[model samples]
Structures are given as C-alpha cells and as structure tokens.
Target: MSDLAYSIVTRDLSLWYGEFQALRSVSFKARNGLITALIGPSGCGKTTLLRCFNRVNERYGNVTTTGEIRLLGKNIYDEDVSLIELRKSVGMVFQRPNPLPLTVYENIVFGLHIHSPARLNASALDEAVEQALTDVGLWMDLKDKQKSKATSLSLDQQQKLCIARLLPLKPEIILMDEPCSALDVEATRQVEELMLELAGRYTIIIVTHNMAQAKRVSHECAFMLMGELIEHSRTEDLFIRPLDKRTAEYIEGRFG
Candidate 1:
C-alpha cells in the first residue's frame, strides 16, 4: 500500500476572476510524499488552481471562491482557521526566484524569526539556517556567501537559495509554479532533480506548461483544459495511454 495520505483535499472548489470563471468546482486529492504535476495551456487555470492550495489567490482583487479546501485534515476556509499556521505548513515557490533583499543568512531565518513559535536566538537561528541550506543541497555553495546579499547570486543559485529559505519553515507541502520556465534545459533539470529528491520528505505540487518536464518530474499528472480538469493519472499511464482525448491531443503535441 502507498504510504501516502492526502495532504490536501478539495470539495467543489471553484473560483471566479471577477465575472469570468477560472476554476470549475474541481475536486481532487493531492497525495502526501509524492509530486503531483498540473499541466495545461495558458489561461486554462493551472496556476489559479495551484494558487488555491496555499490561498495565494486571496491577494487578487475582486476574485472570489466557493467550496472547502482541507489541508492536513482541517478545513482551511473555516472562519476560525489560522492563516499563518496554514501558510507555514504549505510553502509556495513562484515562477521567479524571490529571495529577500537582506543577507542570504537572513533570508533563510526570516520566516522562523517572524512567525515560528520558538524564539529566534542567535544559535537557534544559525542552526535553522544551516539545516535549511543543507536540505536544499545549497549549504556548501552558500556557506561562504552567508554574509552576501541574497540578490548577488546567479538566477539558479538564487532559486536554490529561496528553497533553502523556505525549508527552514518546515513546511509539510510545497507548491511550485513553473519554477523552471525562465531557466535553460540544464538548469531546469537541476531543479527537477531537486524536486524528485525532496518528494518523500515533503509533498510537492508543480504547475508547468511543459508536458515533457511534467512527465519527467512528476509521479502523478493532472491535465487541465479550458478551466476543466481533463484527467489525472499516474505519469506513465497518462503519457502512454490517456483516457481523455484532449489530454492525449496535448500530450501528442497537437493542441493544449
């Protein structure tokens, strides 16, 4: 049996961007300790759907959503829910690497110092930063650069640093949105490798426009079309023998 439990579960989750509907009451289970990939065309709501996992879409103006999203067995939409706690457990990585403007060392411990229950003493903060960096395979690269500004690193290094920063928060789930879109093939592969390596340690969900990359990095894949979830299946089955025509078409290089 799969050791995975559902990290996130949604019931009749739908969203509207003003008058235009983006998500259509889509419900699915995001298994813990595995990478689930969302693949779809532009404007098809892949990113919107991914944003819902961490309530990132709440920042949008005039956007509204209906239904319940359960994270770790609790309804996150409940009135008494703690947004900070929910967010801490579900970290998100954006399309572009967004590290803090402060020192690299500061960026990693920023969240812990700001929100975690434990006090951010000097030794604790140092240990947190070191552990976070080590988890992302970035500790050696950043060991000497801890005093340097976070923006001083290259794009790939910056992205890795962002991951290092997020890891210190000890999130149970990570949502990545087209993290490799701005990268070259080689750099993209590095991030992909990192994602796979981090899967069992943390549940991961990725939204990507690249079908091949989805197949490469994801254990399970969900394809979206015109605001609808066309199909979700194991990567091997979805690519080799799709049940939906639209999914097959997109996978076969026809139209997304």
Candidate 2:
C-alpha cells in the first residue's frame, strides 16, 4: 500500500497457530536497503510478522497463514519458490547470539557451504570469511581468532558473527529480532552502529521493544497493537508527531 518500492510487502496477511490467531490482516512495506523497525508490546505479533517474511513460523507446526507475503514483489507462497532459496535470501538474527560450536571461520562460511552449487575451495572459503567479517566490521578483531570457537567469543562478537554468517549467502533482507537484547549498553551501541552501516546494502526489519533503539536505528517505524498495525511513518515523524492516538499513547508511555 506504500508508494515506495518495497523489498517486503504483506498484503492483508494473517496467521494463526491452531485456533489462536497471532496476526490479523497486517499489511505493510519495508523499503529496499532501509531499516524498518517493528515495535509493540509483548504478544502484539511483531516477531510473527518478521518471521512471515521468510516463512519460518510454519516450522512451529499447527500454523496456518492466509493472504500474501511478497519478497521483492514475488509472492513467497508461490509454488515455484524454493524454501531453501527463500531462507537464503531472507536471513535472520535472533534475540541472543547462538553461534554454532564451530570455529569462527567455519561459522562465517557455514551458509556458503550449504548453499553453494559447487564445493568452494579452501581459499574461496577463506575469502568469504574475510569479506563477511569485514562487512560486519569484525575482520581486524576476529581475523587472528578465526580458529577459536565462535561460542567462546563475547556476546557482541557472537551476534556480529551471526550476522556475518548470512553474508556469504548474499541475503537481500535481514530480519533481526531484538538482536541487541542480550548485550550491555556498550555492545548495544556497537551493534546499533553496525546496523546503520549495513542498512544501505541490506534491507533490515528489526523487531524491538526498546523504543529508543527503534528511533535511533530505523529509518521507518511501524507500531503494532494486538496484532494490528496502528501506524507506520518515518522515524522522526512517528516520534515527533504520531498520527494515531494509540501510537502517541504508546510512545508517550501511557501504556504499552
């Protein structure tokens, strides 16, 4: 419905887990190469909407969806779409860093190993690792520690590695669900900086309850209430002058 070109577009999309509906006719757009933050109280379906972009919710079982979710204008539910490819194109970063037990180098190239049409040579894999880490501003910090286990890294490093891992697959969109929630203030600031740096190259849709974070990191913000989208606007507008009373109330801390 937005006039802007969107990397993700949900058209009257709805979802349910058995009898409990989680999303109700939610329609929105996330513009290409921009950061869009989804903000809402707990159970308001922000995470659900983020997962819908990559169709990850179906893995939970007993879930059903209606309406359309288009990635770059192609309906994701189309019969021709490959789930593996879809996932590769739309990567995710969770609330807490959950790096694989493998070495840092291996973790960064894990997706490449899985998605490459042909097995990449050691040099190619190494290059991929370096580039991915460099993209995330981790090359200098982790280059010497590539042999170390990824889990052994600090929380911020692990989270950055999780994001780096997706790079080898060349994802067009990155879905981050509270990616900084587990880190301290300093680490949160660093990750926020990384998100800003990565925005022009990747469309980012982040779900966060931290209002300040949403304002600081996102170009656009969407507010949700009880699974319904209440307002969506530029970050400055939404914060300075919310169009919806509900949005104003939430932003003003009247109630979540």
Candidate 3:
C-alpha cells in the first residue's frame, strides 16, 4: 500500500523513563481510516506506545526516546514540527471522562478557540458547536442544553462530549487509552458503536485491555509484551490464528 494510506508509522521506535525502557524497538503502521487496537497485559507498554504518537509521554520527566515516528510521512521529531499543531492533528481520549468544567457548547468550541489561527465569530462558533455535537450523535439530546455544565452530564454523555470537543480541531487521528474503562456495559456498547460510525472518517488507535473489545471494534490488532510488539494482524486473525506463540498463549488464557 501507498505510504499515504498509513496515518502513523514507527520505525525502530523505543522509549525509556530514567533507567527503565518502556518500549523496545517497536515498529508498526496504522492504516488510515481504520480502528487499530493495541492490546496486552498490564505494564506492557501499550499506553506508552500510544502516547508516543502525540509525544505526550514527554510530559514525564527523565524520558528518552530514539528512532523515527512519522505522521503522514513527515518525521514528527523534526525540529521544525510544532507541538501545538501536532497535538491538534492528533486528539486523545483518556481512560476516564475529563470534560473541561465548562458549559457543553464551550467544551465543543474550546479547541477552536485555542487552535484556530483566526478568531472565529459567534456564528462560526455556534456552527462548530452544532456540527461537533452532531458528529458525535449528541446534537438532538444536547441542543437545548448548550449552557448546561458539561460536568453535570452522566458518565457516558461526558465521555461522548469529550470526544465531541476534539472535532472542531479537525484531527486526522484519535488516540484512545482504555476509553471505556470506566463505563458500564451498555455505555461501553454505545461508545463502541460511535467508534464504528466514526471509523471511516478518522484513523483511530486505541489501547484496550479488553480482548473482546479488540475483536469487536478494531479492524487490526497489535499485541505487545514486555515492550515488544509480538504480533499485529487483522483482528480476526490475531484472535483466531495469531502468528506468534506468545500472542496465541495470551489469547488462550495463558500467562499474560
């Protein structure tokens, strides 16, 4: 496939935190407009690798990284690359819902206010709020509640609102770190459905501990162990016929 078909690519990418190596020469390509799930046991570097894409892991002190990471074929570590623009292009959803303690409409347009080069007028802001909420299947429910505090919403709605907030920035990729970890089964299902609906429009890379969720929502799955990428393939193939013995063992209820 063409390089343009991949939204993110890592070549011999590795990361270290002080004396601890978190990722070990990991390399993979996540195709555009598809859901790619990173799965593994706890402390397996799944979240570390996901955070590396946006360079957010650098927030922690004593972090060191080597090798290349490319987004749309451009080396992200290039000195000329702007972190603000990189973050705008790559939105992330955390394990728990963390909406800004602002009104619903404000949350939706927050990204635009911060990232948009030109000041957006009231009408443009209004349109952005509507479109963003609509994109996340929340317009009908939250239209009349624009002024309502985002923190007042239920957990599921708050999570969806957090996702909606990223829309105005027009991100090319969405990184979700155990996005549904705090949700109930029904809410998890709804979020998964939303992910599927949004799949063809954005390249989504999710770090999920739930094996079933990996099978259900992702097109491709990558398994990691001790900071190493053990296997990556179609979700069906990864679950049913993993190429690596470790992957098969992990999926078959053996040691993590």
Candidate 4:
C-alpha cells in the first residue's frame, strides 16, 4: 500500500555508539497511516532503529550514524533541515509516562505554545487540545479535569495526557518505544486499543518486547535480532508462517 508518497524511508541506515554497531545498514519503508511494529528480544536493536526515524539518536554524543533517513521525500539529514520542525512532525512517546508536573491543560498546551505559536491563540488552542485528547480517547476523562495538576492524575491518565500533548502538533508520524511498559494491565490495554484505533490516521512505529501486543496492534511487523532485521511481513503471516527459522522459534517461544 506504499509505493508512492512514502511517509518514512531509511536507506542503508546504520548507527554506532563508538565501536558498537547498533543498526546494520537497515533499509525499510514505513507506510503512512499504518501501524508497523518492531518486535525483538532484548538487546536486538529494535529500539535503536525506531529512534533513527525522528533523529533522536542524534542527541547522544559519540553516536556516529551513516545513511539517509527520509521523511516525506526529503532527506532528514540534509544540512538545511530544521530539526525543530522535523521533530514536531515526527513526535515520540517514550516508555514511561513523563507528563510535566503542571496542569493537564498545560501539559497539552506546552508544545502547542512553543511549536505552533502562530496558530495557538485562545480558541484555536482549545480546539487543538480537545481534538488531540479526543483522538487518544481521553478528552472526556480530562475535559473536566483540564485544570487539575497533571501529576495528580492516575498513572493511566498521566500517560494518556503525555500522548495527548503530542497530537496538537499534527505530527505525520509517532514513534512509541515500549509506551505501555509502565502501565498496569488495564492501562496497557487502553493504550493498545488506542494504537489500534489510530492506525490509518497516523503513521505509527512502535518497538515492543511483547509479542501479544505486537500482534494486537500491528498491521505489519519487522522482526529483528542482534541489530539485524530478520523479517518483515503482514502480522498474520509473520506469526503464522514465519519464513525465518529464528523468527519462528522466537514466536513459538524458543527464546525472547
């Protein structure tokens, strides 16, 4: 479904922290408006690969990277690329729920105030906040409590707020790295449900060690092992008829 208008493409992208190569010149296509899951055991470099999409890896020093990461047909590594704008379009949600200790409204408006200042007037900001929260199924939960301190909310709600904050910017893609790892079962389920609901609206790339979660949310999946992409296919095919012996073994619970 992604020949033309590819949302994100990595061409022989490789990264290394000093001498330790983390990604092995991996190349792949992440289609627009679909949920693509990255599944692998610990230390397999799935997380590292996901970070390259948003240039998050660039924040770390001594991290040398080689190759092109293209977003919406533009090479993101281009000298003139605006990291700030690029990041606004490619948002990220980390493993822990790190909502700032401010009012719920502040949590959502924080980025809007900084990223979309020209469009963040009173009425527009309110509308954007409402839409973002609504997208994550948290508007009703947080509407009345928008004035409440963000940290005072339950862990589940806090996580949702973190996600809601990302939406106001209208990002083209979302990178979630084990986003529900800290949540309880119910909260985790809610996040998973939201992801399933979000497919085809936002390009989502999530890295997870949870096989069930991967199967539950992904339309397609890429399996990785020790810094190499082992297989990429439809979720059903990957789980039901894995081509790689390692992928099959992992899915069958041979090892992580």
Q: Pairs clashing in candidate 4?
A: none
Measured by TM-score, how close is model 2 to the native structure? 0.97
* Root-mean-square deviation (CA) per prediction: 1.9, 2.1, 1.5, 1.8
Candidate 2 local lDDT, 11-40, one digit each (tens): 899999899999999999889899999998
Cα lDDT tens digits for candidate 1, 1-256: 1354888888888999999999998887888899999998899888998888888788888889998888778888888887788788888888899988999998988888889566667988889888988888788888998999999888888887877777877889999999988788887888899999899989999999898899899999999887788898899999999999888899998986
- Please, what are the lDDT tens digits per residue for candidate 4 over residues 1-256? 2344568888888889889999988887887788999998998899898888888888887888998889888899899999899889888889988899899888898987886547557887788888888998988887898899999998888887888898888888889999999999999999999988877768899999899999999988999998888899889999999999999999999999
Residue 89 in candidate 4, Cα distance off native in Å: 0.4
Weakest lDDT window of 10 consecutive positions for candidate 1 = 1-10
lDDT of each: 0.87, 0.93, 0.93, 0.87
**TM-scores for all predictions:** 0.96, 0.97, 0.97, 0.95
TM match of model 1 to true structure: 0.96
Q: CA shift at 32, candidate 4, in angstroms?
A: 1.5
Better of 2 and 4 by lDDT: 2
